[model samples]
Target: MNSTFMLDGEEVPFTPGQTVMQAAAAAGKYIPHLCWHPDFAAHGSCKLCTVKIGGRFATACTVRAAAGQEVDNHTPELTHKRRTLLQLLFVEGNHFCPSCEKSGDCALQATAYEMGMLTPHFDHFFPDRPVDASHPDVLLEFNRCIMCELCVRASREVDGKDVFALSGRGTGSHLIVNSESGRLADTDFAATDRAAAVCPVGVILKKRVGFAIPIGKRTYDIAPISAQPAGDPDTGNKLEETP
Candidate 1:
């Protein structure tokens, strides 16, 4: 028998070395998250997956699961916190969803909707990040970046390109290209790279193929992010085809 933990009053089974998020995902339970991807190591940057375990708060993605542990998720307090975080993310970036190509398919947008973030409660930063259209095949819009570091990790760990890195500190932090020219065209990044496909927002977009899929017919349009199966990497664009 596998070791089990209680999540929202339901028993979720887990093997040794699995985190709370991993176990809950394996049990088909949805814990709202933006920075926790099964393909990568636990980052614990986004606190949206923070759950109360044994009366202490912890990030589900990094907290290892133990037998007979009780986890409190989906409570009013946690939901409110998640909504605040979403609102902050929305305001920090110029996430004008209606004008964005990744509007419907964006994990950040979908997760915001899931958390019922109707309006950006905080003041908008409106950072003057310029759009990089230097790459012949890809577009780099830094305004929509949430500092998740998915692209940074994918480029280094998977593609071995080291094409992306986070620069600056605190609120000034932003994504930067590896090239001295500070442009995507100067780097060896291709459309087929893992970093190209790993962005959860509208930051790294392919050129000339915007709006290929109608807004209403996209991934999150058909089903909410909470309904997506855990561990699935599909980000709603459906641009990549399975071989």
Candidate 2:
């Protein structure tokens, strides 16, 4: 018999070794998350994908789905928690949405909209993060990084380049370049490297081109993020993320 579990009162089938978030995402179900990237080992740091399984809270990104289990997602209680988390993220970063090139296509912005976060409930931190325009072909906007570490995982796993890492803890945690100079240009990072790409925020941006795509015509503009496919249908389980 196929393994199955209940998510938000709906039966979700899962293949062995798949986490709750992976199965849910693959099955057209949405669970809020940021740190969980495909192919890389799951990082449950974000806690945005937290779900209640058997009445206990757990991060769906790291929890393996077992048969006959009930997982609570899309609940009123959970929605409020997600909203608070979103608000925290907004305040933690200098995310000037109107001015950011990633405004429309940004997963952070899109997820906020989906969660109905009308405004940031907390005061903005406006942390004094610096921008690295040292790389000839790429820009690093440190202020916008939420420390999801997608770039870190993609670099080490896919590109085989340890280009990035997170430094500090709690509020001080931030993305760092794996170079003595602590700049992206000082590293052997190229535009083609996955570490130089796959940033869900404005942290890793292509140089010389900003707002090339109109706001209304961007990736998350036409479709809600949760409704979008996490993996390519033609690639046979291949995920959209790479280094």
Candidate 3:
């Protein structure tokens, strides 16, 4: 074991391989992040959990802390940058929250409200993305993906199934599923797979639960994310907020 260090002004002991976000979460300080789930391997690709390490901004999900290192949890500079980052995520992908099923309990929606982002400063890309509803019990709308890699990580690490992968290059990059099948229904995907359940947006949804809970009583309707509490350990942090 390595030791404890200053995490958001609190000392939390951690092993050598654990990331800063894990340490913070272990200490009960919830830092908003989309890609860095506790059950999956940390990708640090979202750039949403950028925290002040030393004096500069670094992704907390990947950065391992050394002993005596100081981590600033809350700062105006970090908040400004995070808000801008959320804006980019909002406009880059096709996040049509209104028509989607994962509206209230969506992590992206929750994080945006928590960060106090009122508007997206950039122009919407409106990428003509495709949707794959071929699976029997699941629908995948690639248009809403934020590239947080939660599904990817869960598939490989947790489920031991490498079903999804990111392809293309640069600004045109997007997610591709299965072995060039192009359609999710063509793959050996089950309704209970980790990838299907790990999606944080409308990108992936269960067909049976589309309108089961109704809109008015939905997760977001009951709480605007900021008011919601951190996830419990048992539920894998699956939007278990009280109404």
> Which one is best on TM-score?
1
Evaluated with lDDT, which candidate comes out highest? Answer: 1
Q: In model 1, which runs have C-alpha deviations exceeding 4 angstroms? A: 239-243
TM-score of each: 0.97, 0.92, 0.87
Candidate 1, which ten residues in sequence have the lowest lDDT sum? 234-243
Scored against the true structure, residue 154 in model 2 reaches a CA lDDT of: 86
Quality of model 1 by C-alpha lDDT = 0.89
Candidate 3, which ten residues in sequence have the lowest lDDT sum?
A: 233-242
lDDT tens per residue, model 3, 1-243: 558888667787777877888877776677778777778667788788898888877888888867887888677888888899899988988887788667666778777878888888899999888788788887788998888777777788777778788988767889988766688877777767777777767677777556656666766577655444543322222432222
- Model with the higher TM-score, candidate 2 or 3: 2
Error of 2 at 39 (Å): 1.7
Off by over 4 Å in 2: 231-243
Worst 10 residues of 2 by lDDT: 232-241
Q: How many residue pairs clash in each candidate?
A: 0, 1, 1
